[model samples]
Target chain A: MLNRVLHRRTSALVCSALTAALTGCGGGVDVIGYDVTIQQTSQCTVTGAAARNCEDPAVLGQTSLAARWFLETADDGVSVTVTTHEGRTIPGLLFDNNTNVINTEGCAGEGGRCVFVRRRYQTSDVNTGCSTFGELIFVGHFPPDAPQRLVGRFSDVAGNTEECGTPTINEVVFSVNGAKVEQPAQSLEGARP
Target chain B: MNRPLPMSPVLVGLAIGFAGCAGDGIDFFEVVRSRVDECAIRSNGEFCVEPEQFDPPTVEVWAVETRAEVALLYVDEEVWVLDPLPGDADPATVERTATKTSVVIDGLTGCRTDAVREVGFLSVVTRSAFGTTGTLDGSLSVRSVLTGPESCGSTPVGERTVDVVSGTVSGP
Candidate 1:
């Protein structure tokens, strides 16, 4: 009876040890997921200007315009924020980067500024030809609570050129990619006591 | 898959290691416990080492300087747009659209060298205008010198003005 009892106990302990390992090897918990998009629309009134194949090198003009950005995450532990940038000396495209029309007096300057907030990171792995165009930022967080998300508006510009004057109107489009959140399927193996 | 087994490969091996040694009066259960401790130390509660899952690193914010230029010339009614080049060590060539003209700079470069900027931008600003009467007078000029006193190389990094009609170029 003593030997039988001892054998039973050893077998149980062996099983427990193996089970613990299988669980660990399955896969660690997911940490973060990211999605982002950018869009712009421009319209200009051409006086004598006629467009050619307009492939490139050719100059084009636009009047008023709007631009926006959308950034998001799947895990609430992850946070997101955005900041704008413009050229102070050269020229930037954060919208009206070179034009000043708030007071109608117009901006008489040649330079500008830009900034980004928090620890930034790109959450998605999507290949955008313009990777440096925008940036991403994020680390990890806890509790495994709710999902996370963020949406932001960028800028607007009205033609400020004294020569041709700003364009009449234009349409712009931007995208904020999704986190492609995965819902882990319930496995009956773990449910088995 | 991990259900307890009355006789498993591990159990058989353990039993065989010291099978007949029980005749020497060694406690079988105690020997089994000792063997298990050795195996546990080697495997860390499992039968193998698990690989770690990893993701990309995050970055903190810092001051970023930017510059841009736009020229709406009256001569041929052409527009030129240009913006500041990103300052990174591992450089890359990029094409940025100004207004109507797409400015692709083959070498828009900059770096922190000897406490100064060793960088420049090159691009075909405006397309050649075809007008018999227009003069090469109207040009695009935008400048915000973010470099030290000795800037723009020997050429000077100031107003990046391009002769929009002449198809000639200048930069910061």
Candidate 2:
């Protein structure tokens, strides 16, 4: 009876080990069925000559916005996309194992592993072909193994020039936090009864 | 001529005055002429070619002792400052020497090119008596590699060469 009990205990330990290995140990939690939650926290700031205030609704539309995130993993890197309910989408942001040394800007210090892209908006009429727009910088950090959650910041900086008129040099920053919402639909479709 | 036309003092004075005024008008017009028109840019890659982009670029040349500094202000708030040229470097003798300069291109994407290899010629063609006003006429082949934010994708990085074939600069 004692030997049978020992065997049962060993089997239980082995199952537990396998579960831990599959689900990941420590902070690595399975996010297959969890919905992503993104809240515009108060840790945001803005600076520059024409920088808009963080509290300004025109900056980010609404203080609280509903959004969904998706992730695609490949051999090269992981591509992350965050889409807001209002249809604003920040897409095609890729992060790989090699730390990007260029354009660290706000993504420095602990948030070193990052990928960012700057998009310009509003072409200046007075400056003719010159563009006088706010630079929208989207920076995010997603570790290779933990593609479930993303932590990063967004910055909007206005280009300043006399010929481009007095532009509002807005440098508002926003924090983004999200997790995987659900497993791929194909996976469920392929499941056998 | 009919026994040498006799000139009245008043008529002669008025004629002299009109001649002086005409000369002054010519000088004023010369000074007011647009200095930007004398500059032209040719690029193998992208940027700095469109007329609407840098149509009337600001050109300045400053004479400092034995050297001269030239600055060209282009679109997107970009500036190309060429410096340390021999003061006596005229159009004829400028081609024999080369000057190293740096350029900062701040467009939709910010880029910087350092250690720019400037070949060809750049000469200060004319200068006013006070040395405050002048013009430049010459050409320069600028070659360098721009390094910028990686997040800018592949748009703002790589090798670029801009040839300022013929340009005139106004100095302070």
Candidate 3:
């Protein structure tokens, strides 16, 4: 009988501990980071819009690649900057729902690979439920070995340029390397015609 | 004959005490707010007050995944900058401020949200030291799942920018 009672007491304590951990009250949430992952890869061909030197057949298809993006922010009484894994500065907007809005540019490298980079400062007024984010997308070719760096400043919603209010929350960095991207199958079927 | 059952006030008191103790916890809103700030600082290194000076945040921190790919949409998030004609301040500047905001991305495809559509808007409000406040609006839309010339070759891979608006802040 005594053993059973002790076992019950231990079980209760364990359950309580687990509850606190899951609720993020017992330092659970702090131990983990907050952000979502976004991956993107694209394919382009020399057709329809502008016909350049065709390296690969103008096969209408998508160049599929797997990418990953994580985001975190700090308040500087003004705007927030997002950073990526490769130490590249991320510029984009943030929507009211706390979503990360983004825009990207790339310059082509050897073998017709282009890479471009940019960033935006997204901010929202929590107390008043007002929110804002930056957004953009760049689709084009860049010469191999084009400068692979992005440096710029943050602007207010009204297009007024400003600097980082807090030094710690300023600046961002990222990196991009050549990777093999697969073409979508549907495009292959469509291009056959 | 029936036997009387025993009642324990001590047990009832313990239960009440435990319930009270469990109520102590950090606020969810506060924690999420802090986390948002942390994410901004981590990605941007430094936060800016002005949208014109804003640059793209970093993508290095994320681990690439292809499964969550969203279809290309007609409209996408864009950034724009709009500065009011010096001293164009007015009480209605709040709603009109979004007009002044700029687009970070040049081309985006989407229709405005209406009663038929429930597209969301992310906005931010700022109050200057001189009691002037403004609101910045950023619009986001999902990618469409149709094959087209601009569909990134059938499978939409990346997010695009559509439009941005800026105006003076409003609200009580």
For each candidate, what TM-score against the reference? 0.16, 0.30, 0.18
| Best first by lDDT, ranked | 2, 3, 1
DockQ of each: 0.02, 0.01, 0.02
TM-score-based ranking: 2, 3, 1
How well does candidate 2 match the true structure in TM-score terms? 0.30
* TM-scores of chain A, one for each prediction: 0.20, 0.46, 0.23
- Estimate, for each residue in A71-122, the C-alpha lDDT of model 3 and write its tens digit: 2222321133333322234443322211122233332122232222245556
Shift in Å, residue A10, candidate 1: 12
Predicted candidate 2: interface RMSD? 42.3
Best by TM-score: 2
- CAPRI-style grade of the A/B interface in model 1: incorrect
Candidate 2, A1-193: lDDT as tens digits: 9965555555555444454344333122111221333333333333335344555344333333223333322234444443332223344555443445444543444432455555566765653544566666566665455765666666556664455445335455567665654442112222211
Count residue pairs with overlapping backbones in model 3. 125
Native contact fraction, candidates in order: 0.02, 0.00, 0.00
Instruction: Name the TM-score of candidate 1.
Output: 0.16
Interface RMSD of every predicted model, in angstroms: 25.0, 42.3, 18.7
lDDT (Cα, tens digit) per residue for candidate 2, span B1-172: 1232223433444443343332111000012112222222223444443444443434334221221112221212221222323565444345333333333343434444433443333344444586433333444444445556754455334443443434334323
